[model samples]
Target: MKLLSVNVSKPKTIAYDGKSVTSGIFKESVAGRVMVRKLNLEGDGQADLTVHGGVDKAVYVYDLASYHYWERELGRADLAYGQFGENLTVEGLPDDQVHIGDVFRIGEALLEVSQPRVPCFKLEIKMEMPGFSRQFLASGRLGFYFRVLEEGMVGAGDTIERVKPGPEQMSVRETAHLLYFDYDNLDRLHRALRIPALSQGWRDAFAELIGTSEGAPKKPRAAARAWQGFRTFVVDKKVPESRDITSFYIIPEDRVPLPVYLPGQYLTFKLAIPGWPRPVIRTYSLSDGPCHEGYYRVTIKREPPPVDPSIASGSHYFHDQVEPGARLSVAAPRGDFYLDPAEETPVVLLSGGVGLTPMISMLNAIVHVGKTRPVWFVHGTRNGLHHAMCKHMRQLAAENDNVRVHICYSRPRPDDIKGLDYDSSGHVSVKLLKRLLPNREMDFFLCGPPPFMKSLFQDLRAWGVPEGRIRYELFGPASLLTEGTRIPLRKPKPASGAADFEVVFLKSGVTARWDPDYDNLLDFAEDQGIFPEFDCRSGICQTCMHELLEGEVDYVVEPLDPPYPGRVLLCCARPRTDLVIDV
Candidate 1:
């Protein structure tokens, strides 16, 4: 595959315009190509380009990683720095021809097509050249997202080489089309759904669409009953350390079929705190590998004062108020943070304080899967007393000869120095990390508080760890990561005067006026005494879902479960037009 036109536009807003090419580096991956041409807008008075070719290509429009190609091509060294709608603007390839696990070499870098992108309203704004959005939607050439297998420099004029063809017989395009456009085509969708390459997001999307279709196979009413209300569970477990952090073994009381989750996933618990009018929800990552029937484990750290009041209160409530016998309402597991067992490279798991939960899950999974790769586990904590699951980790290390554990204490107490099996007494500095894991080729997974995670990320980059191999998880909301990061977080400014928007809940028949400051659609509805079912309230849960009968909305965080066409998570979603929602 040959590179065609390398176009870029730096709009006042990160939103794209067909005019001047943006001044930034652009990175492109080899995938199915789509036809590109310029179009004229009636009132915007600007020429916008439209990408065509490929049926059911809705995937490409909303994918952030795929959009990196366009950003890199614009001369932006930081591919994740800029905001472009989609990445590569191509000409020949289509979705039906490409398959998952397919490896392609673009310039010197290697990428594997992991999954199809899911479209969103951001594309409509990016392609505001009259009917550009509509035409692209009709054409259905949504591009795909790729996982970087090998990292190297890429540029325009480089040929894309197909290194490995995917094993699946069906292309992502055929699956997307059958699921989205032709709901009546159940046979094809079900058949494609059986493919392991199909993502859980796509599967959930298809399930929603097909389940709502006319004359679709009706699942037993009992199956739907399982998900109707929140399930409560009471869990009690022991923590190895004497610190405030504790581990709990949780199992659903209703015996409901639990959704299988990945190692680095988290579950949001909704607690009914006394004196609080509404339920309080917080997210905590699972601390164990996947099990068939055993209880899932979670480790929680009690936060002391002087920190943010909200977090401190929440942490205190979980530790002090919530008891071992008390039942807690929980949402299904959700998150994109996961380790790929297919990755055979050396692994480095980094954690600080309570952030060790997910890393424990990953290490346990690696060991469970019997992966023989060299494993380096580095943990940082205030002291041995505060170290959250030190005993469990020590036991695993003792059992597995391939695993190596390194502990760094920021503040070592008199007892900590005598009792702990720590390798170092200082904080996790670059000097210690380099000495422990001399090779920089390992995949690095870091999880911690914002400060700790950020510092480690900077240190790893300074140590020359490739960007592709360095993965991280935000402990709180996506906003936390957006703050002071390379990516710009431009909160939409309210209009000069209060711009009133009429939002009609089509299903509930509740009409409300939305204020610009109360931009969150879900929050606006809740304020109006119209409660939408929500769990995380952070956009991770797909519960506060509503179909968009009319108008537009912007999603602040990428949903773990792909939204059904014209549907959105009301929590972090903001309306862009006078709206109608099926609440």
Candidate 2:
């Protein structure tokens, strides 16, 4: 056996579908000897640590036979020695013959087989074949990943020698096949579990299979969607919460038990206006808790006129057009921002203005669940005139020993009392939070206007609160927040269809798979945790116009006027093919 080449590379970011994808998969061969470490070879690094780069999968070894096979299969002869992103390219140790726990020596380095190289999306990108990962796995010619048992200098053209054979004699190909394809092979599963050199992740998979075959417990699943498409619901009652904000309680028209949802989740509605050509869609937070099973409540504030006429507000239609006894097209409740009622961690619910909607839901759910987690409900508004649910907020704190309510009136009215109206006088700042909070080690949930959310997020991080703990949902674009937050609003909505189509947001550096659930690109981008600002969602305003960088799009809603040259109105556009939009 011989080592053909030694490959090394650092993580590199490249444009893919208009988004940036970083990977260490683009490896190039090294010239001279290099030091082999426990984690990786010299000058090599993995972009994401969760899946790649560890003591076990330290050095990936791909044999030339598999390269030859792929070259023939793909009808391409330009494949390089490090094409498969392997660190060490070799002539021997074909996957079918290389056994797990087998020891090998190349130059002065000693290594042991730990696992088969599981191809990720990076491999598909590397191979330039969209479904190559599945094809590679099914082909059963996957190369092996080895862990450094002894670190030493190794160079290209070094001779490879098998030091010891694995005790079980389970080949890499057989192990991979047994785990991914041979679910019914109980004996092989048992034998594979006994091999000590196999990675723990592989062991867990085999154990899961063994348990599944023997009637063991399965893992829990995520909360699922309640209904498909749209269902009609009647507005049973409307109550004024504040000067402008009103709460509407809507019950399912079928009078069935509504699907349970966690606190902080929002509901989308399709509103039919008098003169609009299409239905106006709006998303509102469920202001009430899940404990109220009979009806869902949305507290909406009547919005003033926008600076742009086409950016006409939806709240105006709700306040003026819709009323009790009106039927509305309601969709399944969905939003990634939510409070897990069962979690015992202390939480701080922070909000400003109408942002109090989701906070109210969370506070109610927390109290209803009866868990002893400490909660600090902090709210800010101009004064008593603008604040909603004052009595309820005070009552929740008065009744619950663990719950603390702190209200801040940014500009309190002359008539508003000192302690009775609000507990604090300024905006809800990190300095204010420090005074109210006992320590800095609690989960913080914030919602409000963009400025309010952004400042608080930056302040919290600066004060040493981990980003993971500082959860928030903003009123505007996720672009308003700093980079690396992955859209502070919520997690990207999962793709609805198996469609291979992808929309790349160039400025946002995000790629969203097309979901047929959305009628236009604007809604699809929003669902995928992208923030493309739009005032009129029906393509009348031209507010959501973005450059069409790479692909063609079809108009779902015809614009009021012709679009700009080379620009598409996202609110009216649906991707006709794979798209790259200059956001």
- Across 1-583, the per-residue lDDT of candidate 2 in tens digits comes to 9999999999999987557989999999999999999999999999989778899999999999998898889899999988999999999889999999999999889999999977766787888875466577678888989989999999988999999999789999999777655543679989988889888877876776666455432221112215665788889788999999999998766443355565787777877877777777677899987733457999999877878775446798888878888899887666657786557889999998999999999999878867789999999999999989999999988999999999999999998998898987999999999999999899999998877888888789789898889888754445567655543434445664544589899999998778765667876787677777786464454668989988888886445456888899987688778999998
Q: Over the stretch 159-181, how does candidate 1's per-residue lDDT look in tens digits?
A: 76778887656665765455434
The clash count of every prediction, one per candidate, is 23, 0
Q: How well does each candidate superpose onto the true structure, as a TM-score?
A: 0.49, 0.50
Off by over 4 Å in 2: 1-225, 483-583
Give the alpha-carbon lDDT of every model: 0.61, 0.81
User: Which clashing pairs does model 2 show?
Assistant: none
Q: At residue 216, give the lDDT of candidate 1.
A: 29
Cα-lDDT of candidate 2: 0.81
